[model samples]
Target chain A: MATYPRDLQYTREHEWARIEDDVIRVGITAYAVEQLGDVTLVDMPAPGEDVQAHERFGDIESVKTVSELFAPVSGEVVDVNTDLESSPELVNEGPYEDGWLVTIRPSDQAELDGLMDAAKYEEYLGTLDG
Target chain B: MSEALRETSLTDEHRALGARLVPFAGWRMPVQYEGIKKEHEAVRTRAGLFDVSHMGEILVEGPQAVAAVDRLVTNDVSKLTTGKALYTACCNEQGHILDDLIVYRLEDEKVLVVCNASNRDKIVGHFAQNLSLGTPWNDVSDAWALLALQGPHALATMKDLGAPPSLLELPYFSVTRASLGGVDLWAARTGYTGEDGFEFFCASEDAVALWRALIEAGTCHGLQPVGLGARDTLRLEARLMLYGNDITEETHPLEAGLGWVVKLDAGDFIGRDALRAIKGAGLGRKLVGFEMTGRGIARHGYPIVANGEPVGEVTSGSPGPTVGRNIGLGYVPLALAKVGTTLGIEIRGKVVDAMVVRTPFYKR
Candidate 1:
C-alpha cells in the first residue's frame, strides 16, 4: 500500500499540501508516483509565478504518459525544486520529501481548509479502484 | 462502442508476479511489474522475459503458400529456407505500410506470419481478399503463447533450462524446435530488443508451466518478468519501428527508414509498382533520429521545428536507458533530414533544441 501521511492535506487530483505559517509546501502524493511508473522529466513552475487553486502550474512526464501538476491552493510561487532538474527520479523515490515541487505563499489561507484530510483522501483513493 | 478487452493465458501469472495491468490495443496487459527502468536495464545487462502473447500469429499452408505470401509482403519470402524468418512489411496498393511483421518459413508448404496485435484482424482480412482460392489459411493466434527472453545473458539462461547447447549455433532469425518441462516449444533466435536472445512459442495450455519453469531456471541469471513499458523503451533505444507509433497506414515503407526490407528487383508484390515509382522520384520526407540537446523528453506527436517554424512531427521519443540520452525519431523534410541538422521540438509550448543523428541509438 502507498503511504499517506496523516499530517498532510490532499487534493482530489492527488497532490499533497503541508500547511506552514504563510506558505504551503506542495508535492504529488506517493500514489501518483506509483501510477506514473518511471518519472523521466519534471517541468516545474518558476518562483514568482502566480498560480491559482486547481490550475495547472506544470507537468510531470513518465515513460507512458504526461500528468499535469495541479495547484491545490492559490498562491505566489516562493520556491521551485531545482534538484529535480538532474535527478527527476527523486519524485519516484521520495514523493513527500525531496520530491516536493514548490512552495507558495498562500493568497488566501482559507483554501487549505477546503482540501481533503489524509483519511478522506485515502477513502477517495479507495473509491477510485472500485 | 468499443470491443471488450481480451486476456492472455498468462494473465493470471502476470498478476501473481505483481504486474500493474492496463488496457492496451483491446487487451488487458501488464504495463510494468516493478519498474520500466529496472526491467529495461535487466534486459540490457542480464535477462528479461516478456509475455508477448498479445502479438498475433497466422498460419498459411499450401502448395502455393510461398507464391501468395510473396505477393503480399515486400521482402523476398522466396529466399527464406525452412526454419528461417524474414522481417518484412505488408503494404497497401499505394505502397503505404499496413503493418510490419516477421514471416517464418516453418516448411516448404507451411508459413507463419506474426503481426502486430492491433492489426491482426486487418491483416487476416487482407490475406483473405488477396490469397488464391483453396489456399489453406488459419488465424491460430490464440493457440499459442509467446515469450521473449532477451539480454546479454539470455543464451546462457536458455542452456540452463535444458535447451540444447547446439541451439546457440542457430543463426539469427532462425527457428528450432525444443522441449522443456514436457512441452514442445518453437524457439526462434530473434527478439525486438537489440540483444542475443530467443522468442519462444508454445501451446497456450502450457503457458503457466513454461513461465514458472523459465523463472525458476533463470534465477541464477537475474531473469525478470518484464512488461510492455520496458518493451517499448528497449525497442526505442534500438530504434525498432513500432507499427502504430512509428509506421502507419499513411507512412510509406521507404520514408520510415525501412528501405532495406523492400527488394524491388526480387519480384512483383502488391505495392511494387508504387514503391518502384517512389524509388525513382526520390523521397520528400525521411525519418531521422534526433537527440534532445535541451531539457525535457520529446514525446510522440510533438511538432518538429526548423528556423522557428513547424516542419514535421515526432513519432517516438523517450529517455533511452541503454543509450543514456533522450532520443527520438521524427519525419523531417529531405532538406533537413541530414545528420547534424539542428532542429527544435516543441515541448509543452516552448521549442527545445535537438540535433539529427545516426540511428540505432543504442549499439550493443
Candidate 2:
C-alpha cells in the first residue's frame, strides 16, 4: 500500500481528490499505477463536461490492461491535464504530480464527506488483501 | 471451478527474483520481474534470460518420428537434417490451426515437438489419433525444462556460461547436445524474440543449476531474468503468431500469413487437401500488421471496421517499444489486406484509425 497525502480524499476505485481552491483535483493513486504497469494513454473528459460522483468519467490505458477513471465528487470538468495525452508515462512517473488527470468544480461540497481520508483509505485498501 | 495452478521447475527461482506470477495455461507462471517495457528493452538492447519451462515438449523415438510429425504440421520436416528445427502450424483436417510449434530434429530416429503449454494435451491427442505408424511418442513436458537467453549479447553470455567452444559457430535454428555444470542438456539457436539467441533444454531437476549458472555468467553482460510479459511484447513486435490469439482452431495458416510454412506440393498431410482447396479458392480474409495512425490502442477481440462497416477483428495489439509506435495484427478481407490499406479498429465503441503495413514489425 502506498501512502496517500493526508489532505486529500480517496475513493474505493483508487482515485484521489485534492481540494484546490474551489475545484477538486483528481488522479489515480500510486497503488493503481503500480498495478497498471506502463501507462500508454490517458483519456479524460474535456472542460465543461459534467461528471457524477462514483461515475466513470474516462479511461486510462496501460500496456498490461485498461481501467476506468471514476469521479470522486459530482461536478463539471473544469480542466483536464492534456499533457497526459502525449506523455502518458507521466502517470507511472508520478501519479500524484504531473499525472493528475482532471480538475472538477464540485456541485455539492458536502459530497467530499463521503470520500475516505488518508487513514480511512489505507484501512479500506487493507481489506482488499483478502 | 478453477483448478490449482501448476508449477514449473524454476518456480522458486522466479519467486526469489520477486516476479509477478499469474495463472497461464493452468500453470503459475511469472508475468514480469521489474516491468514489461524495461524487460523488453533489455532483451532488445542487451540480453535477457527467460524461463520457458512451462512450454510443452513431446518426443518421438523411431525411424518414422520425423515423418510422423511432418504429417501433423504444415512445414516440410523431411528437409530438416539432424540438429535443425522448423516452425509450422499443426492443423486439423479442416485446415483449422491446432497450434503453432517448433519441431527439432534431434537424430535420425528421434525428434522433438515443442508446443504451447495449453495445447499440450490437444496436440498429443492429434498426433496419437491421427498417426497410423508405430512411432512411439511421449509427452516429455514434465521431464524437461527450457530456458532462453536472447539478444545481441546472448552468445557472449553462453560463452561465459561455458556452454560450448563451438557455440560461436552454431547456425540459427540449429540444435546440439552439450553438458554444463555437469548437467546434460541440448541447446538450439532459436528464440521467440526477433534477436540472436539460444534455447536450452535440460531435465527438470537440472533447471535450477542451469538458471543459477546462466545468471552468474550473464551478470556482467546485464542479462535480466525476463518473464512472459516481456516475452509476449517481444514476440508481438517480432510479429510471431501467438497460438490462441493469432491462429486458433477457427483460423488457418493461409489467412494468418503463414503460407511459407505450407508445402502443399510436398506430401500428404492432415490438412493438405483442405489447405489446397483454401489456397485455390483465394483468401476472403487474411491477417495483416497495422499501426495506429490516430489516437487509442487496438487490443485483442476488438472489431475492425473498413469503409464504415465491421470487416474483421484485432488478434493482437500493443505499443511496440522498439518500433516506437502503437502496432497490432488483425484479420481483414483480402481486398483490404494491402500494405497501405486504411482500417478502423473499434476501440471502446469508437473506431480508431489504423493502416496495414509491412510485418515482422521489428528486426535486428
Candidate 3:
C-alpha cells in the first residue's frame, strides 16, 4: 500500500530521484520511513560535494538504529536539504515532497536509465516482503 | 538470516496493531506502534502498556530458598518479607555484575526471580551450579507473559480493568495475587519507567485476552502500547542501568552508583570478598550521567575524551523525551565523574561538548 509515483526513478537502496533538466532531485522513499520508524536526525552532505553512485552520502538516525544514505546516481551535490536540520520528522510526514533530501547535477545523465521506474520498483519492493 | 529472529507470543497481535517490529535481544519485538515519541509522551502524561514477556522468570521454592538466593546476589534477601520485591544483581567471583534482577518473595519459602531475557540461560545456569541439591527451582519463563501498565493513570486503568482493591492498594515494591477480568494473575507494583505503575504476570495462554481487556479498558484513559525503543529512553531518563549496555561483566557495582544494593555487612555471598576488596580500594572510574551541551546525539561506544586523550566510553545515550534534552551515561575518570565536570564525546569523528550532570534527569 506504499505509494510509488510514476515520475520518480528508484534505487535498490530506497532512494528516489526525479530528473529535471540535468539535475536530479533526490529523497528517500515513503517505504524507508515506514521501516525507520521515527527519524531523529538526518546528516546530509554539503552542497558541491561529488558523490558516486551506490556510495554512502550521509546517515539517517532513528531512535533505535542508524541507516546510511546511498547516492542513487553519480553526481555533484547541487543543493542539500536545510529544513531537515530542525525537523527531521519531515521525512516521516512528507518524504516525497517537502522532505526532498538533496539536488544533484548529474555527472553522467545516462545513470538515470539504469535505475528502476515506479512499476519496476514496486515489483522490486514486493520481493522484499517475502 | 531472516529466520534467525525469534518471536514472542504477542508477535501476531503486534503485527495486527501495525506495530513496527525490530529485532531486540534475540526477539522480534515491537519497537513502536504509532511512533516512539508519542508512545513515550503517553507514558509520562497518561498510561502505556508494554509487552515485557521477553523478560525471563524463575521460581525458587523450598525451606532453603532464602539462603540459596541470599548466597548468589549482592543484596541480602533474607530480610525481605513475603509479598515484597528487592532489586539485586548476581555477580562473578570478581564482584562484576552478571545481571541485575528483581527478586520477589511470594511466600516464606517461595521466591520469584525476574531477569533480563538475554541472560535467562546464563543466570539459570549460574543458579543451578550454586543451588544445593533438593532445593526446587523451575524456569517458568515459557509459561508466563509479563505486561507493564505504567504512568500516572496506571492505577485507575487497572481498577477499571477489574483489578481488586487489594491489588490496587499494594505499595511500591509489593506484590499481590489478583484477578483481572476473571483471569488469575500476580500484579506487582514495580516498573522500569519512573512512574506509578504495575507489572502483571499471567499465563502465556491468557496473554492475548489480558492485553486486549487492558487496552479496551484503558482507551478512555489515554493508554497507548509502548515499544522497546521508548522503553530505553524512559529508563535512561530515569538513570536506570541497562544490564548489557550500562552495566556489564567488566563493571563493578560500586563504580556504577549501585553500591547501595551491595551489602558488605550482610555476609557470605558469592561476590562479597571481591566487593569488600573493591570498597577498600578507591574506584578508578565511575559511571556518571551527562548532558550534551553541543549539537549531537552521543551514542553507545562513543569515546569520552579529555585534554585530547580518550578517558572513557559512552554506555548509553539518547534524546530524553520528558526532559527535552540530549542526555547520556558513560564511564569517566573518578575526578571527571563529579557533577559539572566538562567532557567531550567523540561523535562521528568530531568532539561534541558534554557536561557531567546530576542523575535521574526526569524525576517525578
Give stretches of model 1 more than 4 Å off: none
Chain B, model 3, TM-score against the native? 0.98
i-RMSD of all predictions:
1.0, 0.9, 1.2
Q: Residue by residue across B1-364, what tens digits does model 2's lDDT show?
A: 9998999889999999989899899999999888899999999988999999989999998988878888888889989999999999888889989999999998888999999999989988888897656889898999999999998888778777676777767899999888765678888989999999999999999999999998888879989999898898899999999999999999999999899999998967889999999999998999999999999889899999988899999999988889989899999988999999999999998989999999889988
Considering summed lDDT, which 10 consecutive residues are worst modelled in model 2 chain B? B160-169
Best by the DockQ measure: 1
lDDT of each: 0.91, 0.90, 0.91
Indicate the worst ten consecutive residues by lDDT in candidate 1 chain A: A121-130
**DockQ sort, best first:** 1, 2, 3
What TM-score should be assigned to candidate 3? 0.96
The parts of candidate 2 lying over 4 Å away from their true place are none
Encode model 2's per-residue lDDT on A1-130: one tens digit a residue.
4668998899999999999999999999988987788899988988999999999999998876789999999999999999998899999888899999999999999999999999999998888873
Tens-place lDDT digits, model 3, residues B114-135: 9999899999999999887888
TM-score of each: 0.98, 0.98, 0.96
Clashes by residue pair, model 3 = none
Steric collisions counted per model: 0, 0, 0
Worst ten-residue run, lDDT, model 3 chain B?
B1-10
Q: For residues B1-364, could you state the per-residue lDDT of candidate 1 as single tens digits?
A: 8788899999999999999999888899999999999999999999999999999998899988888898899999988888999999899999999999999988889998999999989999999998878889998889989988899888777778777766767789998788865678888988999888888889899888889888887879999999999999999988999988899998999999899999999978999999999989999999999999998798899999999999999999988988888999999999999999999999989999999999889878
* Candidate 1 C-alpha error for residue A126, in Å: 1.5
